[model samples]
Target: MLKSLVVMAVSFLLSTAAVAERLKDISTVAGVRSNQLVGYGLVVGLDGTGDKTTFTSATFRNMLNNFGVAIPPNIDPSSKNIAAVAIHTDLPPFAKPGQVIDVTVSTLGDAKSLRGGSLIMSPLKGADGQIYAVAQGNLVVSGFGVEGADGSRLSLNVPSVGRIPGGATVERTVPNAFAQGDSLVLNLNHPDFTTVRRVSETINSLLGPNMAKAVDATSVRVRAPRDPSQRVSFLSVLENLEVQPAQEVAKVIINSRTGTIIIGQNVRVSPVAITHGGMTVAINENIDVNQPNPLAQGETVITPRTGIEVDEGSGHMFEFAPGASLQEIVESVNQVGAAPGDLMAILEALRQAGALKAELVVI
Candidate 1:
């Protein structure tokens, strides 16, 4: 009874571990991706906050003409509740006819907000200029507001941009050569030679030898059944097979515009000393009026005096041992009281001095 219970516990643990992660999260099958779709249309029913551009009038007129409502050419109707907008959505791989996809609508004209507005019928097209889907729906806008009487407005989220869930209907399918070859290639999102070899080995171990080959660091070619139905099943099995990927390379990414710094876990710093300090200056001005003593005739005079004071800040010093890791780097910098800006300068200096053992990218 004791042995049977131990075997049952082990089996349960193994069964639960088999479905750790879905293959779609780690690897992407080539030719299986989403294509961007875009279109131009108008959003109507605004509360007197629509665009006043002449192009909006022309577009409105064109729409009327299509509906057999002919207006005199001399008259231009400018409605304050209609805005010209652009629509965008993604066409997923293997999308079929009559399937709906979500879409985003953004103002192309000077519309204050698109809240409570409805998008008109618009044909979404691909890069080849062929209409693939049509989008039309009421917009769900968030956080758009009009300013005060002086045109000073405060908003948290953009109201001029909105989204419609399941708005566009797919009219045609995009062509893909997914089933043209006997083998399929799996591309890793991040290229690593070690990861590629491991992926190929794992697949071969399951589906027999020579079933998968690493073409390069970024791509792994796998043989599959010639029949399309069997190929789908084979992929379904291969994707679910778990394989551990290699560690990420050491690197640092900096956002110069935002003053943000991101240091990788694998980054290392050699032995170095860092010193940071701050300085502040203060200025003061004083004016004095001199009047003749009671009766002494003397013209009133004013004298101005200026005083300047400077405070030189004290700096703290910190040292790192050879090959210190990320946590050590952060603690070392913080120990010296370095601000974000000061830390940025120190990181660049370290990279230039060749003491950093990782790639430093300033974006």
Candidate 2:
């Protein structure tokens, strides 16, 4: 009976571990990937926020000349209010011609802002130097900026960068074909040997034995039907096949610049002792006036002196029990009576001292 109890306990633990996370969020099949496309274009209809015609004269003249308007070779076309910009977008898997995709346009010139601007017909080219799409639409700028006299100004978020929703039309198609091949590759977004092997094993188990194999830590190769129509069905079955992916080790990531800290759910700290203390020094200046004989037209003078004071914190150290939960760690640290900034330092020290079990990644 005691042996049976041990077996039941192990079974319960395994069942709990199986439902920790979904496989779809952690792993992906390889052949499916997004392609990057880029192009240069001009933005028009700016209310004086466009590039100055004087500085970028050549760009303005070329754009006008493209529309069959000829400027003399000697003439400088710098005064037209147009901004040159670079457009970028991702071409998803199975993208075809004539489909619309969103594009982002960023000013390549000294344009103050792209608010209330329309992107002209810009041919976005791929790495092959071929026109893959053309982007032309009204830009949707999300940020606001204002400036006034006396150097008064207010701005929220980024003003110069903006995104255009469905602003580009596909003009060409990439040559990559996944449905026509006899084999499919699954690519893991994060390369992990254990996860890859488990995904391959799961796929093979769901399909037929030896149907999927790990090519590397980041890729899995699977055999599929040769016919395009059958391959599509095969992929449909492949994507729906579920696999219990391995769990990521617990870790905590902290960004010092923004004072942001993200703790993984699995993060746990071993019980340890901590103590924090600091001294604060403050100085204040006071002025005094000494006037010689007010009625006798005496010159007035001012004297200044400063008062110095020190404030120190009374600190005590407390030992936490082993296998302390995150709450326990936080409470023990807070008992030191330190500010958040000071606590950040204390946590760093604790992590370095081998007390923190979770990986501490500071950025």
Candidate 3:
């Protein structure tokens, strides 16, 4: 009877662990991804926002040279309205020749803005220096700037860059192919034993009995059909199969610059007393000019005055009993009138005091 109870308890614990996650969300086939492609190009048709030839003479000269024309020996290229730019885009996986993709154009020279400009025929190359796509389209500037005779102008975030949706045509295809061998590999975005086992079990149940098995926390190997077409169809079905991903253990992330704080839903805080206080000092300077009476031969003198002040407000300490949850922690913090920023500091302090149960990450 005692032995039966022990077996039952162990079985229950194992069953709880097995149901954590299914499969699809945790793993993906290896060697399937997007590729980055970049190139240098020029944008024309700007309303006087193009690069001055003196600053970007090479770009202007090259552009004219592309059209089978040369600058007169004494002519200045800056007089021409043109802009030198760099174009960037990501070639999605399986992109074919003649397909269109959006491109981003950024000024590489001293051009003030790219508004109302048209990008010339630009060949975008990858790291291999091979042209993968040809980009040429009207530029779309999201911001605008205006200046008056008084040299006063208001500008938005950035006017020097723009994008062209479906602006580039793929002139070449990037070779991306997968072949099936004795086994197929599954790569996990985040590696964990609990997740790997669940994925293996789920695949095996769908395909057959134990056809897929975990090689490690990060990789799983599965058997595939010998025919290429069958393997492709099999993978299509495998990718859509749903698997709930395991949640990360408790953690807190704080961005100090933005004063943004995010805590994982599973984070827990232990009970402890918290008290916060801050000091502010201010200094003011005053200057006064003393003038001589109307006709008197007195010289003017300046007087300097300085004032310093400090403020101290009422402060209180609160106690938190043990076994406190996140809700209780928030309530206790609110009761002490702690602002978000102050609460962030207090949370850090609590972590150091061994009262906070999760890892504290500050960015």
Candidate 4:
């Protein structure tokens, strides 16, 4: 039979003709990226589901003092319908003043929920300690929770966090440094030496000899005109050039939280023997009442008893032929009626034995 193999990252793999993509799709120009902005703010106008912590009261009084309101020093402002929240958003590159951006608000106090809350004016700051945007708007919460007096609570989604669509206004702009150097650098999103070499050769072939050079696995330097107007046109042409990148490394990713295993098509296995078994122990509790002998002047007492049962399964053993493909491995394992839990253990054992020819990543 023919060798069975699959390309890892099939979802991202394109058709043969479509594999040639715009250079911009795989790489970004150096000095062109987004910055993170964060702010601390207060959320108001909630429907009785708000923070009652002492810090919340102090924050309320501080806000009042800033607005020229004087209160008795001992008066603890116990506002029941206001909450403190942390606001955060990404400031896109070349963002100009007056541009709007969406923001996320997360509760910082004992607020029950952030539903139907409006944020107060908060100045968003960048890493350089400069205020770049101002965020203020009504929060949109898609989840809610309800609790009964008996402490029975049902939650649909996260209620302590919310989002505001286009709520922040940019106050400043982050300058771009694209036109400074005679040569521009391209940074690949997925760094590969083969891809870098291909990109360099493609550019040199079209523009001229030595027009591009692979400085590192991730960075490629290309000669270009230094004039601002000409540089823009040069990049426009450079990003449009189609090039094929290298295939990704074969990997098997497992999510322990969800017990999901994803095996890449390129994944292979050497000859290996695997045994899948299960052992279970169950403990049951029972309560019994002991009564004093008739009129013996003794109180009745309750006694507890536990019963434990153990079942050790003799697992099935299977062997994989050398160079077996991922599909075949899964099929063989399934034919033996091995459960997901058992499959996880078998894969790990194969990896430890060096029979698995792929990276095993657990998350």
What is the lDDT of every predicted structure here?
Answer: 0.85, 0.75, 0.78, 0.87
- Could you give me the TM-score of model 4 versus the true structure? 0.83
Best by lDDT: 4
Tell me the TM-score of model 1. 0.89
- How well does candidate 2 match the true structure, expressed as C-alpha RMSD? 7.3
Count of backbone collisions in candidate 4:
0
**Strongest candidate by TM-score:** 1
Tens digits of per-residue lDDT for model 3, 123-212: 989889899998999999998888889999989978999999999999887775456476678888898787777777878889898689
Note the clash tally of each candidate. Answer: 0, 11, 2, 0
Off by over 4 Å in 3: 1-27, 53-55, 279-311
RMSD of each: 8.3, 7.3, 9.0, 5.5
**What does candidate 1's lDDT look like per residue over 263-362, in tens digits?**
7667899999877788889999999998888678778999998999988889777888999977677767766666667878999999998999999999
Evaluate model 3: give its TM-score.
0.82
Off by over 4 Å in 1: 1-22, 147-152, 289-292
Local error of candidate 1 at residue 33 (angstroms): 1.0
